[model samples]
Structure formats: C-alpha cells, structure tokens
Target: MTVIVRDFRPEDADAVSRVRRAALPFEVTTPRSVLFHVESANPAGKYRLLIAEMDGEIVGTAQVGVAYESGTPGQSYANPQVHPGRRGQGAGGLLLRTAEEHLAAEGAVEVYAWVLDEPEFRAFAERRGYRPTRSAHFQRLDLAGGTLPELPARLPPGVELRTAADYTADPRPMFQADAEVTSDEPSDIGAELDDYEDWLAHTWNNPLLDLGLSTVVLVDGEVAAFTAAHTDGERRYWSGMTGTLRAHRGHGLAKLAKTDSLRRARAAGCTDAFTSNDAENGPMLAINKWFGYEVCATEVRHVRTFG
Candidate 1:
C-alpha cells in the first residue's frame, strides 16, 4: 500500500473529522466544523487542509497555515494527526513534508506543530528538526456521573450570569471581552485581536460554537468574563476558552463563568467535558482541578526554524 498527500476535497470532511477524533479524542470536532474551517480560513493565513490517503482511504490529516495573528511575521504551523491505528505506515512523513513545502512556498520562515508528549511522537518530531518549546495538558471531566461542585448561592455584588444567546441582537461587547482576554493568554506567539469582522467570521459564527451553553459573567451590565463552549450536539463538550478581564481577575469570575457553562452542558445531556491549558497557566490549571478535571493527555508545542 502507498500513501500520498493532497489537498482536502469537499467530500473529505467526515473522514477528516473521524481521523482527528480518533487521534485526539479529547478535542471536539465535527464534519461541519471541518468544512467551515476550510471555507472560512483567511487568505493571509494561506491555510490548507491536507489529507494523507492510502489507496482510497484517508488515514491522516494536517492543517497548515501561517499564524497571521502572531506578533512575529512569517510564523506558521502544520499540525498533522494520523489515526492511532494507522501509524508507522509512512503517512505521517509524507504529510509533514507536503505541509512544510507548502508553508515554505507561502514564505513562512518558522514552523510550529503540536506533538503528543509520548516517546515515539517526540522522537518523530525531533528527527525532523522540531524542538520542544512549551507543553500543555488535555483535561477531561465526567459530566454524566462524577460529582460537580454546587453553584454558589450568591454571586459577587452586582454580578450576573448570562448566556451568549442573550447578545444575539449585538455581540460587540462579548467580542471585545474576548479580544481583551485572548491578548493576555500565555503563548510562544503573542496574538493581538484587531479585526472584529474576522472574529465574527471565524469564531462567533463557527459551526461548533454552542451559544446557548457558553456562559458569561457580567459586572453591572458589562462583560467581565466568559467561558466559551463548543459541543458535538450530543455526548461530548469542550471549553473553547475561559478568561477574565484584567480588572476582574481576583473575583473568581472566570471560574464562575466556567462552572455555569459546565452545568448547562451537563443539563443538555453532554456526558463528557474536555479542556486544555498551557503548562505554565497555574491559575487555570488549579481551577480545572477544583472542578474535578483530570489530566487525560499531554502535548508539546514543537518549533522548527528555517535558516
């Protein structure tokens, strides 16, 4: 059997989602989300969803794109995921090579990817000149059976909980809040959210985002913090982001938003909840632990620079 890498076709969405879910079960992905990502990617990103096909079957998928939001120019990423059952078949190498070529053609001088922290995965990246920079953990919570902390009887003075749906008429406040909080996230690449229209196309209107389950904390009618939620519309749910504005950092508003969102998810019949955080994010890690989440897997962000 021979494996070849090629651009993703419109009909490959389901197979791509299956490969991603099989490779990273802790993450939420759907056919519609895959297609939306490909269709909505900004041209500046030079994004390409590549598929590794063996015969007529798609055994691996990779997302290649320049990180246009990063503080540095020409920084790019090519994250490839091969089905666990299909590894050691040369598909990974082909996918990586194809992605690198495409990114180089697009004028990327530095490339980055996430590799599972396990021995073989790390070895594969290291052999190809990728160096480990930062690590993150994928945490999971049992929403169907495990115990969850009871909601506080009283919120802080003048604070209220609201859902993203409440802002259907106007989502500018929530977008602003997201922009502020995201700019402060820990990363090798510092992103500054400057385009509201881009955010609307790529985030607010994404197919995986669950507006009803996403919760926000309001301080005197102003957006203070929020926990964005995404679901597969059945059993699995994921926390897209949980952040608190600088002014409201000490009031536990982030936790409040997340807890409210999780409760809503459980009530909606989602059996499993998942989230990920950078290794150095002590506060968010502690909050997840407090919510009874356990580390299910770990991944290291690998960087490869072209000289």
Candidate 2:
C-alpha cells in the first residue's frame, strides 16, 4: 500500500483524532482539541501536524515542533501515532520520516519521541537510530467506584489551596512556578519556559485544560505547587502537569494541590483520572501511589539526531 504523508488539513480533525484514540486509548483526544493545538500553536515552535493516508484514508498522524520555550535551542519533538487497525502498513515510518525532515529543515538539532514500552515499538525506534533515554508510565484511577483519599483536615502554616481559575486576572505567578519545576523535570531534552507570550498562546489557551479543576497551593501568596487539570468534556480527567517549587518540595504541597484538584474533579462528574510520571521520579511516583493510582501503560523517551 502506498502511504502518502502530508500536512494536516483543517478537515482532518476527526480523522486525526480517530487515529490517536485508536492508537492510545488511555488518553482523551477530541477533534476540537486537535484543531486548537494546530491553530493556537506558537509560531516560534514551528509546530506542524501531519497525517499519513493510504488510498485516501487516514492511517497515521504525527505532531512535530520545536521546543520554542525551552531555555535551550535546537531541541524538537515529534510524536507519531498509527491507527491500531492499520499497524502493519508503512504509515508509521512514512509519517516519522516526514516529521524528521520537517524538523531538521526547521533547524532542529535533536528530535525526541515517545515509544511504547512494548518490544516491537522499542525495536522500531532503535532501528531508526533513536536512543532510549528516560521512561514514563501512564497511570489510571477508577474515580467512578474506587475510593479516593480523604482531603486533609488542615494544611501547613502559610499554605492555602486555590484553583487555576483563581489566577484569572494574572497567571504569571503560576507560570513562574511551572518554569522552576519544569526545569528540574527529568528528560533527555531540556526545556526552558522563558517565553511568556508563547506560553500564554499555547499552554494558557489550550482548550482541553480545565482551570477550575486545576488546584494550586499558595505559600504566603506565592504559588508553591499546582496540578493542572484537563478533561475531554465527558468522563475522563487528566492531570496535565503537577509540580512543586524547589523550596516548597518537602512540605507536601504537591500532594495538597493534587488532592484538592482530584477531589474537585470527581465532584464535577469526572469519572476516570489519568496522569503520567517519569519512571525515575521516585518522589512524584510515591505521591501518585499514595493516591492509589496504578500504572496502566509505559513509554520510553527516544531521541535521534540528523546529520
């Protein structure tokens, strides 16, 4: 079968979403969310969404872009997803090749991707000259019936809990906290959230993010910790990013924020909760475990260089 890889069209929203959902059932994906990503992406990121079609039928999709906000330059990312029913075809490779060429042309020095932990997926990445780096697991919580931890009776002194909506007038403080914690996150490609405008265009404007369910822990007026939440407008809730500032790491602020967020999410009709954690992040992993989340799937970070 001839697989043709090309730029995504506005009409490809449903097809792109279908492929993503079929390839990775654990994550929530919607047509509007996909369109929002493409339209709202920062131009500095040089973001491109591509699709692979076989006989005029979409079979695979990839999201490619530079880490424009990274403190460091030349870092890029490309994540490809092939439809489950269409897997043995050449769509995956074609989509990946197109993504790499696009990124390389855009001055990317290294391309990072996530490969499923399964042997076949790992071998495919290795065959493509990609080296494994860190791994992260997708965790799931049965919010419908399973028991959740009771909210703590009291928080530490100088600590108060709030939601992302509370920062509506100004989110720079939350952005600052995110920048600090993200810089310390374990990964092969380093990121720097130095561009406030880009962050606002992308992160802050993302459609799936539910600021009301996102919990923030404020320490004496400073954003100490937070758990950003995202939902698919249905039953699933996602912990988009959860982090604690360096100075406030030991005070259980991360837990406090996440706990508050999860409680609110459940109360708002979210049935299932999901989050991803780097396998080597013992502290965060322990925190998620304390909340009764279990690993449902794992993916390894893979990197490949051009030239």
Candidate 3:
C-alpha cells in the first residue's frame, strides 16, 4: 500500500490524538487541545498539520511551522510521528518530506525536529541529513499514589502562593513574566516573546492550559516564579514551564512553584504528570527528580541547514 500525505482535516483530531498518545505516551493531549492548536496558531507561524494515510488509515502525522517567535528568522520546525508499529512502511519518510517541502516554501533556511533517542530513530534523521544538536528527556510522575513534597504550611514571610487564575482581570503581568522567563530557558533556538496579544491568543487561551492548577510564587506581590500546568481535561497533567525570573533565582523558587503546581494537579484528579527538560538544565531537572519523576523517554533535537 502506498502512503499519501495530506493536509489535516478538522475530523482528524481524534485520530491524530490517538497517534500522538501511542507514539509518545508521556505527553498529554486531547482532541479539544488538538483542535485548539490549529484554530489558534499565529498567522506569522505559517503552521500546517499534515497527515499520512495509507489504505484509508492515518499512519503518521507532522506538525510544520516557521519559528515566528524566534529572534532569528529562517528558523523552522517539523515534528513527524508515525505509529510505532507502522514505521518502516514509508510513512515517516513521506511525512518528513512533505513537512520539509512546506517549510522550505515558507522561506525556512533550516528545520529542526525531535527524534526519539533510539537507534532507528537517529538513523532515520541522519540518513536524511539531519544532525543531532541537543537532547531532552521526558519525565513522568505517578501522582495518584506516589508521595509529593509537602507544601509549606505557612508562607515564608513575604511569599504567597497564588494560582494563575488569580490574575484573570489583567494578565499582562503574567505575560511579561513569561516573556522574561522564556528568554532565559535553555534551547538551541531562542524565542522572543514580544507580542502580548499573540501570547494571549495562543498561550493564555489554550484549552489545555489549566489555570487553576498553574502555580505562581509571589514574593512581596511581584511574580518571582511560576509553573504552567497543562491537562488533558482529566487524568493527565503536563508542566509547560517552570520558570524563576533571573533576580529570583537561587532562592529555591522554581522548586517551590513546581511543588505547588504538582500538588494542585494531583488534587484536581490528575493521576499522572509529565514534563520535559533539556539535558543541560540541571537545576530544573534536579527539581523534577526530587518530585520522583522518572525518565520515561529521551529525544534528540536534530537540525538540518539548507544551502
């Protein structure tokens, strides 16, 4: 059977979510979140969701987009995921090729993708001229039964624990904090979060983001640290970001924020928690480890520059 890659349709959300869950069990995604991503993508992103179908069955999918938020232009990304059992049947190659073509047409001079840190996965990217750049680990925590660190019984003097929902009236402060935090995050590609409106549309409004579960550490009324929580509307929770502003670092604020968020998520019916961290991010990784999050999987960030 021949594998044909085509644009994603609205009805493909469920199937796409199924594939994603199967291919990356440590990640949290729902059909609603899937649709939200397509509906809310920034125009400058030039995003495309493509599917690979063979014999009327979708075997693979790709997320292609220009890094519109990048400080440097010509940076793009395409992540293709084929069902584990369906690989080697040409679905992955077809999906990647389709994504590359779309990205190149959008003026992308380089493309980045994450390949599972496995022999076959690495070979696939290398064979196609992609080289490994950095690596990240997917970590999972069993929130239903495993014990999480106890939250501080009382605030530390001027410290207060607040949920992101507490700032519903004006989220500009949250937006600004997120921008500063993202700029300091470890990554091969840097992002500039200058557009408050764009962040409001794509990040704050994302359906998967659980504002009630997101924890913010307020030091004397300023946003010192925060951790974003994403859920699948039920039992799965993911930590989107655990950021401590520059001046607030070295105070164990990141750990405090994550602890607060994780406790909130488990109490809200989330049985599992997942998060990823670049290998070089020792502080965050150590915080997650202290929470008993085990390494579930590792993916190598691979890149290819176009001449």
Best by lDDT: 1
lDDT of 3 by residue, 141-245 (tens): 999999988877877888999999998899998999999999988897899999999999999998988999999999999999999999998899999988988
After aligning candidate 1 to the native by TM-score, how far in Å is the CA of 107 from where it should be? Answer: 1.2
**TM-score, each model?**
0.99, 0.96, 0.98
lDDT per residue (tens digit) for residues 1-307 in model 1: 9999999999999999999999999999999999999999999899999999998899999999999988899899999999999999999999999999999998999999999999999999999999999999999999999888778998878999999999988989989999998998889877878898999999999988999999989999999999999999889999999999999898889889988999999999999999999999999999999999999999999999986
RMSD of each: 0.8, 1.3, 0.9
- Residue 307 in model 2: lDDT: 91
Task: List, residue by residue over 1-307, the lDDT tens digit for candidate 2.
Answer: 7899999899999999889989988888889999999998778889999999999999999999998767678999999999988987888888899999999999999999999999989998998999999899999998888788777787778888889998889989888988898889887776788888777877887888899999998899888899999999888898889999988888788888888888888899999999898998899899999999999999999999889
Runs of candidate 1 with Cα error greater than 4 angstroms are none
lDDT against true structure, model 1: 0.94
